[model samples]
Target: MVVTTELVGLIHMTTRPFHNLLLPRIAVLLVLGALPSCAEPAAPVHGGAGTSPTQKSRPPEKRPDSSYRPPRGFTELQSVAGRVARASGHKIVWRLQPGANPGPLVRIRGTVNDCTIFVHPLAARKVPPNTWAFLFGHEFAHLTENLGTHSATSPENELQADITGARYAMAAGYRIEAFLGWVLTEPDQKSDSHGSLHQRVRAIARKFGVPWRTIERESKRAASYRAGR
Candidate 1:
């Protein structure tokens, strides 16, 4: 009888805590259910290490500007353009257009279409020697991928050409300053056919190891000039 009573007592002791826990839970559920129907729903809990569920994440920052500098060897214009073209495994036929209207004058310096390159002699004579060479290099770069004018207006293609052309110009021994004079003096806005002067200048500056400050200085100078005029 004592053993039976002891076993019964142990069973009661073991179930006491379980019964206590269940009663509170049931009471809580009943209290929640009895609350006013108009009560606001509980806020949802999120499970992340950092950042709130309602907050939007910020976009990534743009890449920092970089600089490059090339060694000297800049000489003949055709030779440099040839080197750039050859580097891309292409051979070009150079053509000189007669009049300004049908030449580079009508279309801003030079162009490479298919296997041929066209430039106006009159237009060539107007810019600094290094810039002239750079122009040739730029056009040659367009022909490098054998894409020609088909990708002319594409920003990606145009940027690639500018970067490649700048490198070619550097290889040909032209300093970044050579093109900066013309670039700063005549900043072209973004167009359907080309990038903004800002984009071009930044690309050239990045490729040739020129400082962004130089462009800033030139822009300020140009702005001042315009203001003065």
Candidate 2:
């Protein structure tokens, strides 16, 4: 069939085998059909949302990190990201890559040539799909900001991304305290990378107004900020 040859050729472009690529045209069409066409989907909250939610109403609660598995409802994450990208007048590509951060904080690492917003396929698939979406947004913030810069030397750029990501995550109904609990606990750094954990968490906390107590506790500066308050 005319369609068959074209489909086969396209499949051949994949690293998979010929037999693997040889699927019924209907099956291929169905698979492609299900995916949303988001050519230039709307940008997400590029310029910040209207107002911040007060953390005063809630008790001092500790939210455990969300499951880090392959995403079950990842499409929603993509749609949300698309909106942010559109709003920001930017774009992002989500992919499952090797060497995802083995820790809780959603990792966002990329370079100039072949950048991708990584989503732990297995982690994203588990419960608390919102966690994965938050990570996706976090990475996008990095990508979009980095797009405006030439090198990755700016720690402010990264912190800005963290703030951007936190805003989206908070707006998306993810517990900022919970998310930051996992993030601030992280105790490693690339020598060439940004500042200490205290700096990063504070940067994100300020953006979402996640409460001064929360940051103080995470940074182990609780007594310091608390005494002043």
Candidate 3:
């Protein structure tokens, strides 16, 4: 007969003359065991490829003042965003959020919140007309895909957005290839949020029917120019 320690303990406890006295205490302990421990925070819920922690962490650090205004070319970007939304068949609503303004007419990237596309002031001010159009096209494509706040790290979703954006840009007479070349050459910064540059460039090229060799050549040239080599 196998007498496991647990069974032995149970037998011993049951045979004890004091077992009735321990019953109330044992019941209390059992009830207490059912309660959850408060030592740690509950895990955050995620839906599909939602925004990463790194991307979410940026907002508080980069938050602008209440009175902060969007940079120049706001009107132009708004117009382009509207056009791209219509072209992409999403018709997403647009809103400009506060943030530091830097780079050309485009610098920061826009994000989707619900059915609305939120553009940062820096993004609005830095990019050229074509880049601006392409960016909005990409964001609006997210809406068309019904991907709400999906993580940019999702390669499939990101590529889909890029393909849709590229088509919209080309239709609107924007130089999407040039924008893609610039993107491909830029140093890797947001890998957790957007995945690898090579993957992105390849996906965009494949989807848009652009020759990968041309994009690769252009990216290398752009990189060399930036490096002053």
Highest lDDT against the true fold, candidate: 3
Best of the two (1, 3) by lDDT: 3
lDDT tens string, model 2, 55-170?
33424243222322223255655564454444444444444343243322234444322354444332333224434444555566665554223233456655666567656555
> What lDDT score is found at residue 198 in candidate 1?
56
TM-score of 2: 0.45
C-alpha lDDT of all candidate models, in order: 0.44, 0.42, 0.48
In order of TM-score, best first, we have 3, 1, 2
lDDT, residue 16, candidate 2: 24
How good is model 1 by TM-score?
Answer: 0.49
Question: Candidate 1's C-alpha lDDT?
Answer: 0.44
Error of 3 at 89 (Å): 2.7
lDDT of 3 by residue, 134-202 (tens): 766765665555333333225555666677777776776666666666566554333354555556767
lDDT of 3 at 188: 39
Which lDDT tens digits does candidate 1 get at residues 95-135? 42333322232122233333334333323322234554565
Best by TM-score: 3
Clashing pairs in 1: 67-209, 68-208, 68-209, 74-172, 74-173
TM-score pick, better of 2 and 3: 3
